[model samples]
Target: MKLLLIPDKFKGSLTSVEVSKAFIAGVKKSGIPFSSHYIKASDGGDGFMNAVAHYKACISVQVISENPLGRPIQSYYLYNQESNSAYIELANASGMELLKPEERNPMLTSTFGTGLQIKDAIEKGVKNIYIGLGGSATNDGGIGIAQALGYSFLDKSGNRLLATGASLSKINSIDDTDVFEGLKQIRFFAVNDVNNPLLGKDGAAHIYAGQKGATKEMIKELDLGLRNLDVVIFDKYSFLYAELPGSGAAGGVAYGLKSFLGASYCNGIDFILELSGVNDLLTKEKFDFLITGEGRIDEQTLHGKLIQGVLALGVRKNIPVIAICGKLDIEKKELKKRGIYDVFEIQDSTKSLDYNMQHAADLLTAKTTEYFGLLLK
Candidate 1:
């Protein structure tokens, strides 16, 4: 039998390639003769570069950038040669991983480093850029990114809008015509999974601002600040992006890219799958089953994530698809109706998150082994 294994990262637990390896080991242990095709995949989040790198061109370039807190830090951007563009996963520079739990203040953090990375790519003569907007620790409404591109945000008193989410309220004017003179010909395809707007109940501040240590009061302030800025941008440029899907992504970084850089939004998982050559691989091989998964399976997984993307492809090709997750939530019927053949959680039994994370590899191997034995029988 032949199996195609393509999984996303189990968040803090394991990577896609790591999970595939465990499954491969379990199948071998069960004495099952199987031809396995492994596709390390992502939803254009943190490991997008690694996924494409496994099948395409990936070059890492180190550049001086800023951290989530506006501090100078050095980070890398991955360049893909086949696409003739640079893939900048925003997390590499402005991710929550660079900050401590206590430092997870969206009110104070900035995406300036991400802007710097874009500038570096522009300088390298890359005309197309793909950006993954996730795992950021900022709510700056993309002010810092605009600053890096020479779009200055000034207050009524003519002072520059400072580097913080709270400072977005003071914006009185914007200048983008001459900013980043070398970027006029560049095109940006922003891969975003979130559909939140720039400001409102379901906007960036209210829905995701809390993940970055925003309090109720802070959420209110951020919402108002972003709303005011949205008004100004629309009045000046006649571009109303406040309600655009994914506009609130990466703390409104999507809005900035769309307004200033003429970026277009695309689903993250779809982008990754296309860039990784998954379609071409599937055309070259036939499989009895396709196994794909992520860290968790829930209602949210039905959204623009990895498993659903695989399911779509599987359905088109009339192939059965199953999933293995670190944790499975929701009704089995719900998953089955969605064309998922089965879902397995990697935990041996119920335990604390810490324990589950620590033993994920072992538990995953055992479960996969048991499943394979049943298949063999």
Candidate 2:
């Protein structure tokens, strides 16, 4: 029998590669006669760079950049010389993980650091840029990124304003006189997994600002600012992206890039799968079973997440798909309805959360062994 294991990072525990290794060990321990192939996957979030770096021979470039809070830090991106392309994850420079609980404030954060990385890559003569727009800490609607690229946001008095969530409403005009000339030569692809619009209830501020430390009043203010910016963008660029799918990704960075940089958006998982050549493998290889998973299995997993993408592939191939997760929150019947043949959770109910997380690799291996052993019997 042949099995394919593709899993996302277990978040605060094992990486996708580590998860695959643990499962492979479990299969061996079960004494099952099987050949296994595995791939590390990410849905354009924190592990995006690692996933791409695993399959591509690339050079790492490090640059000095500011964090969301304007603090200087070192960030890096992967560059493929052969393709003249660069892969950049916004999380590396301006993600929520970089801020402390008390320091989390969307109104004060910016995506300037992410823009700096892109600027460096552009200066390096890359013709293609793939930007992962997840795990961001800002709600600035990409104004900071624009500022970094030589676009000035000016007030009614013609004074330049600092690009931030709180300052979006004060902008009277956008000037691109000093914008980089090479931008016209490069193609920008924004990799995202969500389809939220740029404004309204399902939009950037209303749906995501609270998590970035915004209160009810602050969310309203941010939404207003986004609406104001939307008006300006439409008047100047004649493109109404506020209602477009994926415009809300990265707190409206997707929309901003689309309007300012002529960027195209694509699903993160699909992009990764294509870039890794996994789609070709799925078409040519036959497997007895396919296993995929993430940290948690819930209704959200049915969206454009990594597990769902894998399940879709399994469905097309008419192969049973199994999920092994840290926690299972959905009913088995519900998962079955979505074409998942089985689901397994590795946590011990008697254990504390810390204990389970700390020993996730061992628990995962044991659980996989036990489950496959039963299957073989």
Candidate 3:
């Protein structure tokens, strides 16, 4: 039997590369004479630049930037001189992983760090910028980024405001007359997967802020701030983007780029897979099963994530897909109905969450052995 393995990072557990190694070791324990292939993939999250560098030649340009809470940090982005383009991952500077649980209040965080990275890239003569909008820790409606690029957010009294979620509701206007001239030449693209808008029930604050340490009251306030931001943009540019799909990505950073820099949005999974040549590989080889997964297989996994992209490939290429996850929250019947042959939850339920995370590799390997031992034999 031949198998193709593709997995995403298990978040706090194993990396995708480590997971693939565990799968190989487990299959060997099964004593099944099976050949396998691996695809290291990303859906434009934190590892976005790594995925692009895997298939293309690019230079890593390091910069001094700020963390989500405005602390100075060292970060980098991929640059291609030939295309005069740079690829930036928001998580490098503004990700949820950058902050401790106690430091994750969106009201106090900002995307100004990411904006600094962009400004550095622009100063380096990059004309095209692709930013992956995922795993951010802020909900400032993009005002922090705008501020970093030389725009100013002002209160009703025309006084400059600090760029943070708490200040969003106080922003009465934006001043961009002093923005970097190079910004006008830069073409920006937001690589996104989620379809949430910038505000309201399914919007960034309501849907994602809780993950970045927001209380219900904070969420309501952030949502109000985003609404105010939309109104201010409409007043200035005659354009409203709060309801735009994917605009809510990265805590309204996507919305910020679209409104401030004329950025466009693209599908993250499709872009990354195409870059990694997944379709070309499938066209060349016929595998019995395509194994793919991520940290958690939940309702969100069905929407524009790497698994959704891999599932589409499985359907198109007529390959059975067996997905393995560290934790499974979706119903197996639902996945089966959607054409996945099976879903494996590899954690030991008897163990504590910390224990399961620490031993994820062993659990994944054992699960792999059990499955292939029963099926391949």
Q: Please tell me which model should have the higher lDDT, number 1 or number 2.
A: 2
Which TM-score value belongs to model 1?
0.91
Which should have the higher lDDT, number 2 or number 3?
A: 3
lDDT of 2 by residue, 43-89 (tens): 88788898889888888999999899999999999999989999999
Per-candidate TM-score against the hidden true structure: 0.91, 0.92, 0.96
Model 3: per-residue lDDT, tens digit, 327-361?
89989999999889899999888889999999999
Give Cα distance to truth, residue 2, candidate 2, Å.
1.9
What shift in Å separates residue 114 of candidate 2 from its native position after superposition? Answer: 0.8
* lDDT by residue (tens digit), candidate 1, 1-377: 89988788788988877888888888888888889888777776678667656766678889999898878888988887666798888888888889999999888988889999999999988889988888888888878787888888888887877767988888888866659887779989878866668888878898788989999999999999898889888878999998987898888888878987889998887877786687887788889999998887888577566787888889988889989988888788899999898888887566888998888888888888898888888
Whole-model alpha-carbon lDDT for candidate 1 = 0.83
Q: Which residue pairs clash within candidate 2?
A: none
Residue 9 local lDDT, model 3 = 85
